[model samples]
Target: MEGARGSESGKDPQHTSLDPFQVKDPNKLAINFAYMLEEVGKVAGTWARAREDAEPDAPVSGPISDLLNTFLQVSEYWRADQTRAIEAQTRLVSTFLDIWTNSIKQLGGEDEENPVRFEPARGDKRFNDPDWERHPFFRFLKQVYLATAQWAEEMVEQPDNVDEELRQKARFYVRLVMDAVSPSNFLLTNPVVVRETLASNGENLVRGMRMLAEDLAAGRGQLRLRQTDATRFTVGKNIAATRGKVVARNDLAEIIQYEPLTPTVYKRPLLIVPPWINKFYVLDLSPERSFVRWALEHGHTVFVVSWVNPNESHAEHGWEDYASKGIDFALKTVEECTGERKANVVGYCIGGTLLTASLAAMAQEGDDRVASATFMASQVDFKYSGDLKHFATEQQIAALESAMQARGYLDGLTMANVFNMLRSRDLIWPYVVNNYMRGKEPMPFDLLYWNSDSTRMTPANHVYYLRTFYLNNDLAEGRATLRGKRLSLADIKLPVYLISAAEDHISPARSVFEGARLFGGPVEFVMGGSGHIAGIINPPHANKYEFRTGGVTGGETFEQWRATANVTPGSWWPHWQSWLAAQDEERVAARTLDPHKTYLGDAPGTYVLARD
Candidate 1:
């Protein structure tokens, strides 16, 4: 409301007229439809050529045939969607007429007591203005829009046998249509914007246009929908500022050891394996929320793996390279530094997945150096990887592979966009309104800053990850391999502690539950409160959310476990610390660093600051 503005001509801003023709042009849509038809024709031509070149009796069931079939199927689905859109528009017209009729009846005093009413869907704050319901015409228009949106959602159907990727694509396109036509998105229909336009006398519109242009330049023409400025936060100075020193460095990762806080420490050390997709500092965001600091204060020796931001030279690095040369190397360094045989290992997200594979490989080779394993929001079983599976289809993966082949790595911006879309309402749309429509600057926040500091994935490693774990789902099926040796999760009989976020969209809680069952040993699975990042970073003092923990014996479903698990308030970190304490031997004098083995410079290390 504050940022909105109308024209310089002193027109009634609340009823400011907008060019109906300028609302939306269908020319781009027509062009896209024509292009799709042309592409389909090309595919058909290629198929015909292939058929003619083949032997008379030979079946035409190869790559070209598959391509043609996919194109045809997509076109069919598009046509179905077009029909649904038409049906929704017809419903809109009928609803409009009904509203008109109802208004007349009310005007004639036939239905004065039961007058026409329009309310937005519960939790939809877009049309909460009392003025919309006060006027019958506004109410009718709002209802028509809402009804059309609902009809669009209901009518767009996917066949049972259609490719999941195609279905997902169709659903996404449908949502795009719905968002585009929402009254809240338009200048004329948005009450708050209209009111603000009247108050500001067109200045806000000029400011909004300038903001939009700046975002276009800064975000490379993509909508800059983030709430935080990417350049405001520095790694070591503010974020990931936990005190520590790098003790060892390898081709893949840097091992950092935090200085001890207490007079004595547990005999076994704790090593953290953070996801390589982003910088490791998510675990050590700031002094107030740093899990690394918490672990140190609790009298445990802490070590973390900081993976290098890879490039063309490291493009050939694979899972084996990460597992063998990354985690394996970190574990050996922890042992050498602490003078201990085993270390309690902790992995978050993809790092946890890699840790699981590495642990299984180690168990297969009869190495028992791992004291225990903890997987936080990580999934070894990809069967239920949630909406992200939409991008793992063979065709999608092949397209991604081509992109990576040309660049030597998957661009961080590409990966960030995919994750952001998973929670667009929370992460994308609000910022569109705030930064673009409202003409406001982004606010500073530590978590969002960390989110913006993303890292690239080397081509070889990323492709193998998508193919083996996501596309094939080979890890859980006992078919995945590491360094030419087949890897299986069941082989690892080590004690396990698994944490799953109740609202995590990335590694869904149910999938994490299934992953817990894959371990062939005692497992303590805990359901943490909130989504992927916030759930894990919640500190004990915050007293914000709740967690549930129980013994998981691999025989019950996630729902079953939830039904019987003990619900505990506060962070899960204390429970984990208690569990770690139980697994410890006699406490000893705090260990000192082995100065001779130390390398690299400091706490966060150079890898985190490396850019493409």
Candidate 2:
């Protein structure tokens, strides 16, 4: 009744032309803001005291000092005041959501036993607050919350000679207020952090209620686990269902097949190898967006390795098992099924890393059936990358290795946790405050849905990868060997296409392009736009993304070519397709499957989309 009265009593019904969002009581808003700020001052005071107490033994040494100074400079975050304002809003939002959710829960929304009190934003939607704030209802609500928060902060700063207990209460209120006003809370839902935060709030009545909106958002949208009806990618009986039937499977492996669109497969055989870190279908995410499907349409006979989702049951299988099941057996089948001398191979991310390893393996064995290799955003060197490197330290990797021992495979959530940390602000925080306080669902978005599809990696495979390539730089240096093979990059004398994104942290652009020097074949290395995922999924509908390419190194190192190259925007796919066509002969026989060979039902063969 009070909120309704403020909306109606303060308004001129006929003056609809006026901005309805204009709040009548700026003083109320001002008072609330003061309270929030006072609380913030206290926080600043606490940080200052902590800084003094641990004065760092008379300041850090030269380089360390420089690093600390740099850290201190950025600590202001350039939006301190904005952050303060947010703190105030968080408090109100928490209070309002707590009251609102409880009211709704009591009122009931159809489901009596476990009623859904509020609706989340569209499955994984992000909000544009300016647009929403224009509405009288939201604007009024916002003003009240902000004003209340400001007042709370003002009290914290006052000369009340308040006890530590009172000061702590003030800080909590300030934290709540800021939590509500976060940009992430407005849109972009389905974060792992939001779920955890909401769960924690469950113990604290009001705090938990504040998180209801985000919690509900996580439960419903792209972030949430959904039981979707199988999508139709082809015709009846031969539709491109999620992961096509595993035509060939055994203890060592499974060869999964996609339902073909055309009556006959391409003239040349195509092999796909996905990394064990995640599922394989990143190439075949959906009918429209799948790169694998695109190749099939262009008349290239495509065979994707649908990896087996491994658990403790296959704990014994190490990097050797994956090589045998994922790459080795698949190659054997490619040769057996098609009488062709060689086939084209595409390796994505870690799959590409492994492909490079396999190439060395093949080179050692003198198996020259593999023709051209396409590496999509895969890195061989990790030292040059930003932020991600900080977490890849020896200690961190050791800790992670120890943790993954209990279960043979690293939990999908564990990997997700690390990834989220890399870009916490972009990935985790907003959903945190908003879900807990505002009680609104973030909207649905396809990209976020794709991100949430987490994947797990076995202890052995992950450890070998971290130790061998990422930490050791063995492959980049040409010293790495797997499966007792004298693996060397120079051995795999085949044409190669290496793709990396400029802004990618997982595989830095420089690190990715570095592979060109390792091969003795024609290397067409290109730098793309977007980070790791978006860079590879460079579809036309994709946002402002691009790549840089030119000057084929007759034979050169990664840095030399990068120095002289120029950058450009748009799809590298067409360019790659063109390059791939010139080098290869037409497929002799169409894509085919044998009922004789069964799928092994394990690793990068099928469960790529279930990574989350």
Candidate 3:
């Protein structure tokens, strides 16, 4: 890496030693702080006088008053926070002075360990250059930034008075501040960007500007880090190239029936319910990594729901629409094609949520079409739905609804941005620095491409989902209704296999465990080692990660279950296969699709290809 750093020299005549001090100079930062403080003081005085004039004799009791009081309290908290920050800065300055004094006394031979060792966080490659630590000024700046970030994190802890909604927002804002102040975001401070600029004779910067302009134009002024060139992968060609036929199609979904690879198949057919937020091909990305292929090879007839990339015409489609017109229809189609009354079902992410709801609804109506249920990284209980809850607040939902109303659907780009922010260090900023700052093209990664190729949600569908599942959490509470009939997870008495990603941020493991407990039947909960996507798509051949499994009773907590759970190495697919086979009837000759219902088309159907 050190040798590579020197290779860029003499590439550009205009290149010079980049001054780290030029970026985020303490004196300049202090001046900016002073200006902000003065402005805040003025605003505070105006607010005080206005409050005095408007509510001279009124008791602060109304909603407006409550909001005002909350604001004042938050302001006070911020003021105290600022004081602490200043004291910390003072201490840092004092330490720097001592270090400078020692350096002079020993003629720069002071060999005591540097008070601040700049260690980048996991996955943060910006400060990987040895040059960053070798320079005293850069090292000092890194320490200051890290210390400030730590202080900000500590300060952002919500007080008892702060509501959950406000607390989440506060934490989000604090994170934004931290991200904004990261030394790598700037041109001068980031060694990689500086080196790239010099190596490319400033061409990288020009190319970056052009890319920025193009993105702005394409995304309607929203800054989207292009993770992959959209043209690199095409559905049914190089991506979701799995062989299958579209057995059924509706306004909401295209149900694909995969051809079996084995001579014999399980008596019960398998149906996959994938989240509509993304294309169904995540399970069928390519032959090597395709879970669909794995299942088919294991002697099980597989079916996948390819949800339509909804448009303005589908704006009125809500959760009910997804339940009735989506999975319900898929279930009926599967039964019709296979001549089987009962089928095994697997749901991933939001698709799992919808499947759970459908099962509950089916149970309520005394419809016993489902033989067994498998939920993959899906949360039925929203109590601990993870960071996504931050965007489910009333105000946030309303704002989102307004945006959707104008667009007729929640734009895929907008949804992508929200998910990216949850892991911005890995998803957003890295791409920003690589593509925009260094003008490097994004690598052709199948998973990242799938992540980028998102689908839009109808306005009504999105709003209803956030409010019903995320906000009110009506489904878990048995308050959610479908087609004038109330549904309860307790009503669904079928055996269930729940798989949750151990490191999932979208659906926390504990939340998934809670969902598993809701089933009033034998539940086998498995914890996979990776995150939401990687965890579910884990194939047995790779033998990449491990999984934990144990009988989960309704009484024990997630931690308690984990304490004595059986830890098994390698993919959970084999375990799932065993459980699924046990739930299934005896193997029979592979069945073909019904001749009555004509085959629509090949797998990775048109619906998956339809982009918003």
Candidate 4:
């Protein structure tokens, strides 16, 4: 093993100085391998035991069957065209030959342009290691994998005779398959993992397997891939640390009134409605990045809805319950605290969707308590929505509903996995490598910690949301209803500010732009850089990403509006603050939640702390 640590001259099979597998001790490696196998057996045993009493995975069956059927359809379509099938086969064979020829040329010390050349997509970190390009063995592996992946994608694309929907699903599933089988994901194929495995004398595998077993146990026989150091940060103490008191509490949510930071505050209080899919802390991550703290400092009375991490008892809750029991209750609480009849409201993601519907419903009753509305990274029109739409088909939604009905609610882990699958390469695979393959824990990240802290969705609410919003496209089409009253976005005739991120896969920018037009009042649409979370949590101090603003007039396409929009550097928070100020400039003496009022708890509240 010591002699195998050769110089970086590329003469030895173990080219790097760290390679320890050349003269490995068979007994030591065998012991470690035995321990790993034992751990894996433990994981499997735990899973089998869990299955004894566990409800069948309702949500997974539909999507899995759908994916399989899509591939079957593609396979039939490909086979139907003999010429095309033969061509695809020939192309794949030619690519393999090219790789072989290139390997031969490199072995003979011949300088020649390779017949096959491929580069990993920009920002793909899997192949960033120098050895991937410098070492012949690793280089060949990377090229071969890339070539095969490209060929598979081409096969999916060429089957035009198949239904467009099936083709799209096929493309998506193929990508998932390719990402899973990438050379970087395997131990011997990935140069870095190979070195790590050798350097640790197989200890890495033992430790990694032990960690995997622990994770499986923690998730009750399911893999809850650890994204960050969960033990490092407590909710109220470190992450959602903004000073506030939960002045109003109910079965669905707690309304928190933050401590005032200024002598005067906006007469119109600000109420924030966060999506129940996760906790409300994403906006209040830290003091520096806390949007709650920022609003307080800007002389606005901020009230946030911290939704309960629900359980089976709350299974009967629906969208109307969330609107009336959650937002309406919070709104009434804000009015009582600040003596303000009208308040500015902000919603994020699905929270925004609920707010829009609630406001429209309020308008029907002539309730004008909301002065202005701000939507961040949310969608009302699912027509232009992203890949998530693929999962919300009628068949899949029915399966999801049945699963939720059987369990009384949808598990947070199931929902989290569905969202993570959309960006599996970034959100899923990297963690697999670092946690299980490299035998390391992820560093403490507040955002990912918040992500990991998920909440269950009530069956009634989730089913209605998927069917009404995703499938039927009801909200934008004036067909959505709540609390026995039909609601329409056009009925909400208040100043509206809509902002979306350019790279947001959850809610596409075009979808947000299209939804913006549905508003009856003046709408200002802003496009920000980065994805959903980063773009929204962007603090002014970071000045990291730019945002574009344009007047959203009727009859203009999304492209047209973006083309003529005014670009501004830094966070959109300041711009949002300015727009909020314009809604109602009246300033009154700052108010805090009265200590005399029956308070539930601190800023984060108990609902956020609950975990399954």
- Which candidate comes out best when scored by lDDT? 4
Candidate 2, residues 414-476, lDDT tens digits: the string is: 566557645554566654454333333456544454455566667777777777766677777
Please, what is the whole-model Cα lDDT of each candidate in the order they appear? 0.75, 0.57, 0.77, 0.86
lDDT-best of 1 and 2: 1
When sorted by TM-score, best at the front, the candidate numbers are: 4, 3, 1, 2
Better of 2 and 4 by TM-score: 4
Q: Candidate 4 lDDT, tens digit per residue, 47-125?
A: 8987886875665678888888788888886788898778888988898888777766665445564356778888989
- The reply for model 1, stretches above 4 Å from the true place, is 1-142, 156-181, 220-224, 553-555, 592-599
The residue ranges of model 2 lying beyond 4 angstroms of the native Cα positions read 1-244, 250-253, 262-266, 540-544, 552-569, 592-612
CA error at residue 208 for candidate 2, angstroms: 8.2
Please provide, for model 1 over 1-612, each residue's C-alpha lDDT reduced to its tens digit, 9 standing for 90 to 100: 111124443433443233321324356435544554454454455455545663222121332344445445655644667775466567667766776777555333343555334555676766777545544445556767776666555544534556666655456545645665677776667655555544454344555555665554444433344569767788898888877788888888999998888999988899999999989999988788989989989998999999999987898998889997789899899988888889999999999999998888888889999989999999999988876775666776777777777767776766877788776656766666656555567888889988877688988888899999888989999998876678878788988999999999899999999888788888888999999999999999999799998887647878898999999998999999888788775688988665665457888898888963
Regarding lDDT, does 2 or 3 come out ahead?
3
TM value for model 3: 0.84
Better of 1 and 4 by lDDT: 4
Clash number for candidate 3: 0
lDDT of 4: 0.86
Model 3, span 1-612: residue lDDT tens = 011112145332222234432443456546544554454454455545545553111121332343444455555655667775576567657656664554343223344544433355786676777556555445555656776666555555634556675665566656755786788888777777766665555556666655665565455545556887767887788888878889889899999998788999999999999999878889988688989999989999999999999988898899889988888899899998888989999999999998988888888788999999999999999998887886676766776677677767777877888799777867888777877678778888788889988788898888988999999999999899887878788888999999998889899898998888788888889999889999888998898889999888768878999888899999999999999998855989987655565678878788888875
**Model 3 off-target regions past 4 Å?**
1-107, 157-172, 593-598
The candidate 3 region of ten consecutive residues with least summed lDDT is 1-10
Note the residue pairs that clash in candidate 1: 5-197
